[model samples]
Target: MKIQKFGAGVFTIENFLSKKECDAYIHDSESRGYEVATINAISGPEINKEIRNNDRVIFDDTELANALFQRAKGFLPASLHGW
Candidate 1:
């Protein structure tokens, strides 16, 4: 994993997921279906098209999440300076 840091806490990891991995994720999400995306406001989570107009799938797949996190862990800092 190659990480590139830009100014102002911006960063990017090239090829974090290969084409095959990305395709699998897309397929899985599509199979589950997507709902209108929502945004978190002071009022709480709600669909706000102006803010974010897209579809998303919210699911609980801890195994997948942990796998991805582990793959990227080596490129991540233990903690941020101010956060």
Candidate 2:
């Protein structure tokens, strides 16, 4: 059986970003009146877990991935993560 990662979908983004840029973006997001939480790297889709939706987002999947999920339905907010 293929050992697939289970929990919530994950995201990969630029990590080594300048503090100014990071802080500015995060601050701007908050100032714009948006809830945000910055965590260490893209771990897993985190927000609500009781939904029982464990999905993986392979952004670069050559097979086109489960197709570009616009809604990422049943998991959690896609852009809720920060730097």
Candidate with the greatest lDDT versus the true structure: 1
List candidate 1 stretches off by more than 4 Å. 81-83
- Number of the predicted model whose TM-score against the real structure is largest: 1
User: Please, what are the lDDT tens digits per residue for candidate 2 over residues 9-79?
Assistant: 55433333467867975675556563333323368535543543343322245543343243233344545
Q: Estimate each model's TM-score.
A: 0.81, 0.27
Q: What lDDT does the true structure give each of the candidates?
A: 0.91, 0.44
* lDDT, candidate 1, 1-83, per-residue tens: 68889977789999999999989999999999999999998999999888899998999989989999999898887888956
Task: State model 1's lDDT.
Answer: 0.91
> Candidate 2 lDDT (Cα, whole model)?
0.44
Backbone clash count for every predicted candidate, in the order shown: 0, 0
Model 2 / residue 17 / CA error / Å: 1.1
